[model samples]
Target: MSKRIFITGIGVISAIGKNASETLSSIKTASSGVGEIQYLQTVHKGKFPLCEVKYDNTQLCELANIDPKTRITRTSLLGIIAAQEAWRSAGSPVLGDGRTGVFSGNTVGGMDKTEHFYADFMQDAQSGDIKTMLSHECAESTERIADSLGATGMVSTISTACSSAANTIMLGARMIKHGLLDRAIVGGVDALTKFTVNGFNVLQILDEEYSQPFDENRRGLNLGEGAGFIVLEAEGIAKEEHILAELVGYANSNDAFHQTASSPDGTGAFLAMKGALDVAQIEPSQIDYINVHGTGTPNNDLSEGFAMQRLFGENIPKFSSTKAFTGHTLGASGGVEAVLSVLALQNKIIYPNLRFKTPIAALGGKMIPETALLENQDLTYILSNSFGFGGNTSSLVFKAYK
Candidate 1:
């Protein structure tokens, strides 16, 4: 039997604030969280803007309830922080009769601690702890998060560059709709490290200034680090409890155009958005808001703008990228931005697209600037898009819960 999917709870820890409440406040004020790196040690510490979490490793461990001596990866710590809030917010579901699962997405998994200790182990094979005790594999993050929540049904991680988490959420919804699981926890995490920093720098895509997605002056993306999670419950289970919203539609497609760059026409992106609309059974005109995967890279902005033009044209819904507020969190970016999308639908608040001065000449449309929280227009449905490297593209449709 086909099942309905609804989001019962959401939890987030971004550079803007510690939890969802603070992030909403920061968004309302149009303030920024991007600044010089403070917590993580990187050679580009002060050279580029970054969205770093406020808590140190110790503080995170305390909140996650992990032993101080246990060496959990930075990404795992982030997942734990977000999962705690999400499960708690979901009224901490009771699993006497229903099956529950967890799906997490991560790209740079456990690299922070691994890089920190790699040389130490290599240099002194006989001197100290091998430090291979931590789950350095990408799937390890998903396992740790699932075990933390006692989610014993199913668990996995997706690592399609940036679209990983969005795809994870999409999969969870499918599992429920297909009656595979009654409830699922879906999100992602990635920590800032020298590896990613230098990788982007080497690709010549790291923006020195605040990332301006869909802006003409967009230089590149500012790398960020954080985590976010959402509790997706079957409709029957969700109606049993009052919650935030619903998962209406989602889609994924690969352009297969280029490895690191999207097709000039954004074919894969357009397909994902169109597929989401199809799943929602919603016409493009019904969408109230759009949370774009605006990475601020010249190629992404142009390609995404072109896709938007093709999708919604002049009547495009209100949309913005939260990246300017919380630098690109890479693997965590999808889930982090998904939480932001649900916020807009639930609060009727449209976060300003920071740093947008002029619309791209390619799209030739007036960009939606930062707007104050408007009165809720009875928002019924929302479309959130996430695209990644390797031509991976995905979109989610979150509907307002009854």
Candidate 2:
């Protein structure tokens, strides 16, 4: 058997909550974080709804314990907060003895700051404080989180758009399975910025009101921002600590179908889900729940719903898209939903797809509805999907800790 990887800890910060506990509470109550934009100084403020973190930069800095005068980006600050929570939740075990690694994923990185200073920098490239652009690379936030947590070994990043965090978790699992690391801190973080908002706006996929995933009349997706991290350790090492969940199966696939949309048949989504089931050695019927990549966009919801229909057939497992609560968190969606999946297994509850109304006509009513808390349900195995731009897709299977 392959080396077992266990999730020892989890942390999250999104529009819904400042930490994992708060997020769980919101999910349980079906409280949505999507609303009018607050932080980002976008022209589309009243025109578009967003799942922006409630804390402003100053508040986030205080919560992250970052120096008030530090020139860090909101992306890094959000990551530090969530990553620190995960580290502490994992017992803050001694790491960086060359047996630990940090694998983080992100798409926005420090763009929030870059966009803030771009005009001034353009006016005077020589006079501008180049330091503001120092963290522009996608790896900067990952490095910041790793440094803050004292993860001094094998720091790296993955940036495959929305699947970034799922890929990071996959990488960490492989590293542990191959004896490259005994423990790995893995997750992704992204902060709202004018860049992403405008980008999605131009694509005509940003919902003016709150998004409704799997709904027939869904307008589009509401952009969101946040971070989530989980600590993965070899089973032997995890036995010394508390095991939150088990990482049993994971897979990544690329459809090369379209740059900004999924294929009509959800090829990448199907392949990734199938590959994950194969790796876990579990039948499709074994999945007790599915956290779908239902972004509420016309193409994404249709594609993912069709994929579920193909994979689960007539008796599709209970499934719902939590994005309606948190919005489309871009690269952090995978990590955020992964944490939710683990929480579902631990709590024996499947979260409702908030705001869901009419089901997608294409899927023949396969989508999970906004049912009451599925309390006492046998949620043993869960599959979480994250499909991103450029046809990059990933699926993670998290099981109840045995």
Candidate 3:
């Protein structure tokens, strides 16, 4: 029989709050996690607003069930913590032999430690940079997370910039539908590092103040980091445990326009949304809430706004971006946002698009940029978008289990 996939559980560790419930609470209050960089010591600490996780490395290690002396990078440690949440939330299931697997997305894997090791190695080539820092490569985090979760089958990671985790979830659903595996743990994770901080600054797209997405005066993105994961199980398996949230539709498309910028009209974004709707066999009007990939970047907001207008026309469903709460977790953002959307489905909450004062003149204020929709009423289907660097775009549809 053809299998259907469901999000059984979610675990998240973000800057806004450590756990999913806390993150949700912060979102409800529209609490901005933006502040001076507190976790890492950097020269630009107070010059710009960045969302830094409050925990120290020791705290993160304990959460991940790892030894602080092991020297795992922040990226891999973040994945472990969130993946543990996903595994625990699934009743801590011990799958009977090879029925389970894992797929994750991440870009900065163990980079924090790798950079340090590299710097040390440069000073003295005899330094054992490969000891704890060997798995600093992006794929290493995925391998380590799979090991921690005991997922022996088809454990892998995808690194397509920002859309990494969104596509990870999409791939997991497809694998189940094709009988590749019965159940899969899928998500993404990223941790803050000085490398990313300096990189964004070089692009000159980062905001020195709070990030204002979908707002005309918005400066740029505020880099935040965290880990988020979701357990995707075959319908028959998850329904037995009442751990199912139907992953009805999803799609991914590349803009092929720019290395880091979106197309002028969000052509790739449009393709992804349309593809997701088609997969769900639903029309545009049928969508209830949309969790947009609003990065607050000038190019992203303008392009995404244009795409929304072209697709749903006048009746754009209530939509918002959760970046204000967690900031952008890079590869983990998609997984984190996906879990949030499922929460929105289960709770019928439409999170606000924080800092949205004025809409772009081009899109005609199409999005419902308000924080009040989250606590409104019943919701049916939600469309979530995750657009990444390199013109990669992905969208997923989560429907309340009936």
Candidate 4:
């Protein structure tokens, strides 16, 4: 049998909170971070709601303890902050032994900086600061995080859209299961940029109001920005008391039905969830709760709801999407949700799906999400789903440490 992978630590920075503790407090109190745009300089500033991290670049640098004078992208800064927190939470293990790896995911990369560079470069060929474009690649943030943590093992960056971070966690777990690494830092990050904001706006999926996932009257997703990372260690390598949860299963799939929409029948979603269950050797009924990929978009909620019904049948487990609190964080959603799942397992609490009122008629209006927080429940195995554009879907099964 493959070795078990245990989550030893978690770190996150989102609109709801800046760290794990604050995130938990927000969830417990049903506080949402979605609000009017404040940081990003865009025409949609007052037109659309967003979940920005609430920290400027200089402020983030100070929190991450990086020199303010250093030229860095917001993506890298956010990643460094979350990654450092995860490392410290994991007891600051020595990574110079070369058995630790860093796997991160993001679609935005340093577009926040790249956009500024282009604005000036387009105006004048040599006017834009070249330094601003240094961290433009998707791998730049991942590399920066690895360097910061002194990780020397396999370093990879996955950009499968919204499923990006979940895929990183899956990859890290697989590598450790195969004896490739003893420890892995896996998650994703994305800083809000004019490019992403305008892109989604052009797609007409940005909600003017706070998003309501799985709601019949849901408009669309509210864009958010942040980062989340978790530390995974081989069962034997990590201290028993430090183990937060066990990553029992993970799987990825693609529907190939549309460029930006899931299949009407949820083929990719079902396959991904089923595959994860198969890997974990568990039944669908075994899942206690689900952190669904309910993006508050009509197509996504419908598709994911159908997928869950197909898999769980009449016994669908209690589930909720925390997006209502943090907004649809795009590439960072997977990692952010992953951290939330671990928090749920750790706290035995079910976070509410905010703003949910009426259920979708297509799903018989019976698929109502958890609208109120429930504390001290029996949560064992939780399934978290992250579906991205181009039908890329991923699911992860996290089991409470026994």
Best by lDDT: 4
Q: Could you arrange the candidates by TM-score from highest to lowest?
A: 4, 2, 3, 1
Residue range 1-402, candidate 2, lDDT tens digits: 668999998999999999989999998887999988778897887988899999999999999998889989999998999989988888888886878899888887899889867878778877566788899998998889988987777999999999999999999999999998999999899999888999999999988888888899999999999998999999778855489899999999997899999998899999999999999999999998999998989999898878878998887888888998999889888889988998898899998988887877777765656455678878789999999998999999999985
Model 2 misplaced stretches (Cα beyond 4 Å) = none
Candidate 2 global CA lDDT score: 0.90
TM-score, cand. 4 vs. native: 0.99
Specify the poorest-scoring 10-residue window by lDDT in model 4: 326-335
lDDT of predicted model 3 = 0.84
Looking at model 4, residue 372 earns an lDDT score of 99
lDDT of 1 by residue, 1-402 (tens): 467788988889888987899999998888888888898887787898788887888888897889878878888989988877888888987643438888999897888877767768778866434565466789887888887887788788899999999989998999988888998999889888888889999999999988888887789998888898999998778855657888889999997999999999999999999999998888999988888888999999788878888999788887788889998898888899888877877786677888788777766656554544555457777788889989999999888765
Which candidate model has the greater TM-score, 1 or 3?
A: 3
lDDT, model 4, position 323: 94
How far is each candidate from the true structure, as Cα RMSD in Å?
Answer: 1.7, 1.1, 1.5, 0.7
Answer with 1 or 3, whichever has the higher lDDT: 1
Best by TM-score: 4
The TM-score, computed over Cα atoms with residue i paired to residue i, of candidate 3 is 0.96
What lDDT score belongs to each candidate, Candidate 1 first? 0.85, 0.90, 0.84, 0.93
Between the candidate structures 1 and 2, which one is better when assessed by lDDT? Answer: 2
